[model samples]
Target: MIATLVIGLREGLEATLIVGIIAAFLRRNRAPLTPMWTGVGVAVALSIAVGFGLQLVEQALPQAEQEGMETVIGAVAVAFVTGMVVWMRTHARTLSRDLQASASAALGRGTAWALAGMAFLAVLKEGFETAVFLLATFQASTDTGTAALGAVIGIAVAVLIGYGIYTGGVRLDLGRFFTVTGVFLVFVAGGLVLTALRHAHEAGWLVIGQQRTVDLGWLAPNGSVRGALVTGVLGIPADPRVVEVLGWVLYVVPVLAVALWPRAWRPSPERVPRVRAVLAAALAATAVVLAVAVPSGGGADLPRTVAVTGDARSVTASVDGDAAVLRVSGRGREDQITLPASVHRRVARAGTGADQWQVTEDVPATDRPTSLTLDQLVGLFGRVPVGVSPSTNPGPFAADWTVRDTVTLTTVRSGVLEATRSERNVLTLRGGGLPAARTTTLDRDVWTVPPADADRAATDLAAAQTRAAELRLWNAWLPLALLVAAAAQAALAARDRRRVRTPTTTTPGTDPSRGPPADVPARSLDHAVR
Candidate 1:
């Protein structure tokens, strides 16, 4: 609810401001308001339709595709909002003048369609942004109806504020309003970045740096109120992966620094264009480097063999890209099976000919081989022969066997585990070599074969590589494009500022028919609305 409300208020107010400026300009010019209002109505309806249509389409997609779509939409929303924030920050002071100038040009054309187009385009810009933003918000939220209600309320409040301004009953400091909202929106955009990264990961497009950085699930488990608030409004998960944390930090730090930086510390108008051009070029270059440098697959290679040794027996597994093989051997008996990592289990004969028997088990998928330790493998498949005295009939005997083993296995990454297993095994011996009336010791050993650990590192790496490729386009390059665009806008704004500051030469007896001199400062259209 809070998430949707914030989005509603931020986007709704922007739209309201645009409408107020257009309406005030039309009224001041004595132009008919009907066409402009009609245009606004049509744009609003279209924006709503687009928003709902997107929602319906998302609902119809498979879970993986839905996650991918959500990621794309969230990323686009963040970019849009970031652009809007920066553009508004730089141009809010002159917004009224710009709107009035556009209005004058439209009115000069002497066509209602011109006025309508101006209003339509202005309102449509804000409306479309609102729709996309709301869509992203809804996807993040658990309750769509509540999110929609919050948005409706926000729009209502904005409309009331707009009406009050138009009636001269309210005065809002546009600069301060935008600055404050811009700061808030920066955080919101940061959340969108985190959200997009998560969705991309879920969609199997991103795979690197997946280790959990922190686990706060004990405090705010998923589906809990606390979790919802944190995840929905802030996009911080209870358990966040390394990439999510890194992405959030990278996005929020620089964005907030730029958005909240003091105007006094900003570059002088004379230096603005130079600075903007330099920044733009640097960003473009960096973008190119990133595009070229990021690898196409998981940065690590899969190991050829993963082996685990026990007290008397050992198991070794190998994967050759597509197929997997597991070999278990002990007590002069060797078992080999051709296993595909895709399946959960495989059954094969462990011994040759008369000594052969069917063994059924599988290797569990793991990030590294060490997770399948030698002790675990020994506990699962180790067998040793024991010679007993003649008095000890070996038809069926149950004995407790304790085995201690140290296991070290390394794959693309490394992990280690040491374990001891104590178990009671029932054994049936068909024949035994023992001496009668001779002092002989009884030997006991247990034999069993359990599932081997499947090396899923390759599969996971492949998935990660695919995700990284996708992110290079959506997350990395898209943001760079937006930065370049913002830089260009800043450069143009600086040029405009320089032009405005230049003094215009005027003769003492200028013709009155020419109206006010071009040097005359335009009255604030917002003030006219109030």
Candidate 2:
């Protein structure tokens, strides 16, 4: 939502400024307003149509193609915003003058259509920029309604501010305003650059640098509010990729430095200093050293296992780490428990009586079960053995069971059962036409660790192999270079600010009728359009 709001505010203000300048120019020249307004309307309609067309294209594409499209769109938005920020910073002080000059030229042509075309082109540029930015932000957001609402509010506020300025209700330092906003927009554009790189990776255009730089999953789960704000507004995911962080740093640092640097700091060919040259070389060396020292880490590929127990009435369990599977079968009834390694207690009961068939004692035990009493054995084997109640006739006693543990270990057993241990294991019961019975002795064994899954093991190998191949020196050094440039710019700005300047003085008795003189200020025309 905040992302969209910034987009609307920035773009809307640009459009409003253009319209205000054009309107003011036309009213001063006694030209018709209808044509300019019509052009603005048409440009607005075209921008909306283009936005919808992009959305349609995205929706119609396959997943891979959709990712590719998002990458392209994100790239375009970053470029547009970067260009806008730079252009505004360079031209803001003279913006009103330039717009008025252009308006005069268009009106002097004596063609209403020319004025309309000029307004159309001017507004279309800003409108289309807004459209693309909003589209990119919407793609990144989880709540479209909130994003849209924020954008609307931003635009409305921009309009109000523009009106206030035009009507003399408000005053602004346009140069400072553009400078500060340009700095902010540069960061926003950097976020878009990172977003684009991520999309490109998803589309498989780029295969290197898959390692995560940081994992914030524990602190901000994917769908949490804090996660959404970070990812959607700031473009930083909980788990960020190495390339994503590099891209952000590389793009933002230099761009922000350039935007924020004072104009007086700009180097003149005649004034290049030896100290500045030395600083540049030092910064480059530092970046090179840092780049060479940084190491790339490998990706993670953990193994998982699935365990199944029993037949007919079965229990299936899936676990990642250390675990055990316990199955109890007797009569026609069966029960299973997929216990974690931490579990150390067991409870059960027996009998045809409803109250008799209940869990009796459940006490914590430090060791795995190796022996059981008659009552405990009855509960472990199952409550209703042979599926017979006290009211029903009994069947001949018979029971068959098997417990197998596989993956990281393999273990198998048959007939009378006892306690067993394994990382991933399962127990099954067959032929359960039995009467209630108690066992006194049972056998148990520990499982041996087995080899990891072949596929996952292969993936881990590949990830290791790619570690060095994925290392890009530029990714590590670019931010350092930008930081150095920012420092240099700051030093230059400081020097320029401290230098004294002589003010030019007009000769006392110069002719007052010399066409108002070159230094005379132009009459303020802003009020005409307001």
Candidate 3:
């Protein structure tokens, strides 16, 4: 919820500022509002198309491939966001004028296509950025409702702000606004960078060498809200590594230096308000350092866990090093679990996002352990909680008590509390200071699975597969679409070039070359226009 709001506010502000600047220019120049509104419509349409296209393509991706797509897109987003931040910092003073000129030029061209192209590019930039943010959030959260709500609120706010600025209802200090927001943007961009790296790491584009810098869950559990807030925003690892630490530094230091270090904006010393604006901007400039400079992630908090079980009827079970469970029942095809993945095994994401055993020996179909190490046992110290029960609302399935040790897991399902020593055993085990909580459900932050009796889980699995297939199909189709779009763009560029060159048969002494080069290369445009 908090993340959605932050994204809404940040992206909303960017689009709002763009529309406001263009509208203000139009209203001042006495241009008919029709073209401007048409441009707005075009922008909106393009943004929607991009958004739907992304959703469509994403829907077809398999889980791991989806992850890969997100990682690559996120990395691209980070680069774009960072570049924009740096560019804005250097060119903020001239932004308003450039926007006005661009708007005016687009209008003078009087081609709806050109106008649409201009607006589409502007809004598409915002849309792509927003998409990246939303996708990153989606990977971390399971709440579609919250994300939808945030996007709606962001668009609504942008509309209001954009309209108000154009209609002259608000007098904003454009220069100061960019300066302050630009600094805040550094943090926002930094978050994007971190998020991108995380996705990339998961997708195998980056690697964290085998190392656990610290494990402090016993000292201070990291699942708390405060811990969550810090981790989500700052990219702090509960267990750090040498590479991740250095990677963060390599990204943030240069950006911080550029943001800070005093620079004069309005050299008009006579303008006191500009100085005040600078001071207001100073606050953000100074604070941006905290985005990356604060180093506090080196702490031991990666969950250390253990697994335990009690005696059961109709079944025999063994425990490994005070953690993990394995059970074998007569003729029942061995059922056992040495340790529950979490104190509560959450039902979402197919038990991912936490309910994971650091299975060292790789549990196979066989019931025998291959090898075990003391290090593995110590790691298991924080792997399980000492309790088990059917989550009151197990949905469709009856409560399953799975006994799994180093090798096999036999899970039993039951509906009600009819237990003699004969019913599937209610195994309870405890270690450490945690209260003896019951059940195999993992954290609530994860997506919930359907009850045991509920067929929804199967349906969800089917749906995920369907989406994965669709993503595969889209992957096959995207190259074709890009080809078409590229062809269109090239054709349009050529047409534009033709229209700009040689206004056809200039009279003697009236050199068409007298015109200033509209497409002048940035470095040179020596002589003045006629």
Residue-by-residue lDDT tens digits, candidate 3, 16-50: 66655655545555555566567667766776676
Tens-digit lDDT string for candidate 1 (1-530): 77667677767777777777777777766778999998899889989998989989999999999999999999989988888888877776566666767878888998767989988888888889999988987777778889899888888887887666655676777677777778877877788888899899899887555667888787667878887767777767778877777778778787788778888899876676667666667766666676567654433343443333343365554545434455556668876656444542222211101111122332232321322222332343353333543245332222222223212222232211111112222223332332331121222222222224332443445455556555555456555765766577567767856765886676688852233312212243344322
| Model 1 regions more than 4 Å off | 217-229, 273-530
Best by TM-score: 1
Which digits, one per residue and each the tens of the lDDT, describe model 2 over residues 271-290? 44444556566666666666
Candidate 2 regions with alpha-carbon error over 4 angstroms: 217-228, 269-464, 472-530
Candidate 2 backbone overlaps, count: 4
- Mind sharing the TM-score for model 1? 0.60
**Candidate closer to the true structure by TM-score (higher is better), 1 or 3:** 1
Error of 1 at 425 (Å): 32
Q: Give the Å shift of residue 327 in candidate 3.
A: 48
TM-score for each prediction? Answer: 0.60, 0.57, 0.46
**Top lDDT model:** 1
Candidate 3 wrong stretches, greater than 4 Å: 110-116, 142-144, 173-180, 208-210, 215-223, 265-530
